[model samples]
Target chain A: MNDLARTIEALLFIAPEPLEVATIQDITGEGPDGIAGALEEVRGRHGPDTGLELAEVAGGWALRTRGDLAAACDALRARPREDRLSPAALETLAVVAYLEPVTRREIGRLRGVDVDSTVSSLLDRGLIEEADRPHAGPTTYRTTTAFLERFGLARRGDLPTLERFELTGPEAGALRARLEHADLIAEAETGDA
Target chain B: MRGTNPAEGRAGDAGNLGGVPARDASAALTQEVEIDLFQGPFDLLLTLLLRDEVDLLELPLADLVEEAVTPATDERWEIDAASQLVLLLAAIADLKGRRMLGEEVEDEPDADALAMREALVGRLVAYAPFQRAALWLADRLRAAERPRYRRVPPGTATPVPVHDDPARLSAAIDRMVVAPPAPSLAHMGVVRRPLPELLVRLRDSLARLREVSFDRIVADCDRLEEALTLLAALELVRRGEAELRQDVPFGDILITGTRA
Candidate 1:
């Protein structure tokens, strides 16, 4: 690779977070076309067989452990992680993820619960943040790039649809039975006799 | 399996409802059976039930109310959870009753009831996608084998210390917002009269009275102006336009202009 590509690779390697192309341009004094070409070169250099892959995640370039090597890495070192999302947290995050720049009231309205603590927890984890704009309305929140990085998504559009979690055969059967029971109880209690 | 309900055997196993009579089993079903799909705040249970296609109008409200007010378990009820659950159930029950009443009496459906139902169903519908997304996220987290790499690990960096005193911060901002009292120019050095202007003025004064004593020229002048007058007298002497004489120590010098 040429000097530009090598320099870009070095910068991405050393950066604590993903490096944006504009940042690379600022540092290297390279034009957009030149930087794009160098990034492509850097990406190409890290082929599938390589341990680390140059991934474009969270709107920037990052060097990440290859998906297949994750198991081996886990065996090599037990990385300290406290990122497990509880069921409540996942639900709150899902609401924020899909309907972002949303207010606490809007989230509560949809989830049918108060989400104050959940919102604060997400904020502390750096997975979501308050939108920084002046307005007369209440404060709003949106997912951070850290959310995408942790979930291995390149962008919000990469998120899977909710249809994937739609109740399947057995699960659907169980829910149907519960509904039937509720109907029966309603009839018996209302003096249907 | 279709003819025989297995949930019947499992019913007694649910929360302290073992001795519940057959007549009250349905109420037990509503109150005791914990949903296996998702667990969260009691408020979310309504949406999950809605997602499962349980008609809100058909929910066993009277029986559920009995179960809520006097739960079968000896365990202390979470007051917040119980109160919120009762509030939601009451709202749904009210909506159900009004809709039924409208169907019986009114030729046209009640707009208020329709709006309320629409809002409730709309919340359910909107929340359904996120419920599914949450499951997907959980699955993704479980399946992810390798955590992302970091050259410098997170949480290692020292956090920037913050001054968190609200009153002081407010005062600081208030001080900034109101334009500072127009900066005092008293301490600033500003020449009221330029040396050149003073020099010209002194020469003109000498011309007006050719032999004026230095003390008379500076009688009304300040210290700075007095110093400037002395310099101007020297400049005149340098050009041979004036002469200075002091007969006694610490006496004022006399100036004599050369011009007629």
Candidate 2:
């Protein structure tokens, strides 16, 4: 490996969170485009059969253990985590994730319940956050990077596919793009059932 | 499930020689309304219409509105979406009645009831995607959020959002929503115990004595005045006007002047 690739790997190893391309540039005193090349080299070295792999998550690059070793690491550490979210929290989180930039009133309407406690719980857990839009009335919210991290997604746009295999709705042919999410999944999210 | 048997249940209830108790009817109503809450409002409406094999656009507005507003589905999320649907139905029915009658332009109000009906149709059409997306995302999260570690990128050097204290996070959110104070009045009248005064005091006190405890230095200070004096002393130390020493963690911090 070259000097730049080694430096980038070391930097990723030391970083406590995902490092954006811009941040790497500031520290490395290299151009954005140049750092991209180095990142590719470092990522290439840590592939299958390696202990770790480089990932681009939450719109930034990070180095993490390969997926296969997760169980082994947890077993070795014996770290028991009490992190299962309540059903109400999961429902509330789903709303914020998909209909983000949505206000509390909008969420309440969708869920048909007062979501004050659930909202507070999600906020405390670093899942959803106030978008703080300059609106006249109540506050609005959006999901955070931590939310994506918890759900094992690279970014917000990578939400799972809900498309039905068959399309037979009235506007299916004409409104294909608009009605993309309307397909009925055979066995979709557990909550949906 | 209720959609499949609404008629049968109603038929069964009607056949009763003895009228059902008020409590049983209300309990059944609450249970029915609870069913509609989880299913998106648009999806529920579509299901009800589809169960009767009715056309979507040419909906029976009056019948649907009566069902929605009255105790059919037990109205909840009633404040926003339920009410909106009821309003839209009323507006559509009124518009249909007006068209049946003559168009009275002079007496007509400016709300454009026809336009409101069109908007409601558009909204219901738009909601199909949201319902699917919500289910999609929820299933994805449920699958991913197990206790086991999920592969992710290496974190940055300083973790900004990784604070243990939720109060700080909440405070940061609160600050964002609130308007900041004007800079003109900032620190306007803080009774600053001048750094020079603390420096002179430290110089004189240290001159008489080799070193003094932080408490002894601020012994004369009253209430919050000690904080100001400490701030001044720190400023003096920053400028090499004084020195502070500590023998151990959580131990007494000492303040003294330059040996000259």
Per-candidate total of colliding backbone pairs: 0, 9
Candidate 2 segments exceeding 4 Å error: A80-82, A86-88, A156-193, B1-135, B138-260
Q: Compose the digit string of candidate 1's lDDT tens values, residues A1-193.
A: 9999999988887778888888888789999999889888988999887888887778888887787777688786677765678999999988888778899999988889889999999999998999866778799999998888777667776786667655565655445444433433343244323
Candidate 2 lDDT over residue span B138-226, tens digit each: 67666554324323334534456553588988898898999877678654566566656766777787778877788776777764567
Winning model by lDDT: 1
How would you encode candidate 2's per-residue C-alpha lDDT over A9-117 as one tens digit per residue?
9888876667788878877889987898999999889878898888777777878777667678777666557576766787677777777888888988777679899
State in Å the error of residue B162, model 1. 25
True contacts kept of each: 0.43, 0.13
Candidate 1 DockQ, CA atoms: 0.21
After superposition, candidate 1 runs with Cα above 4 Å error: A75-77, A156-181, A186-193, B1-122, B143-145, B153-260
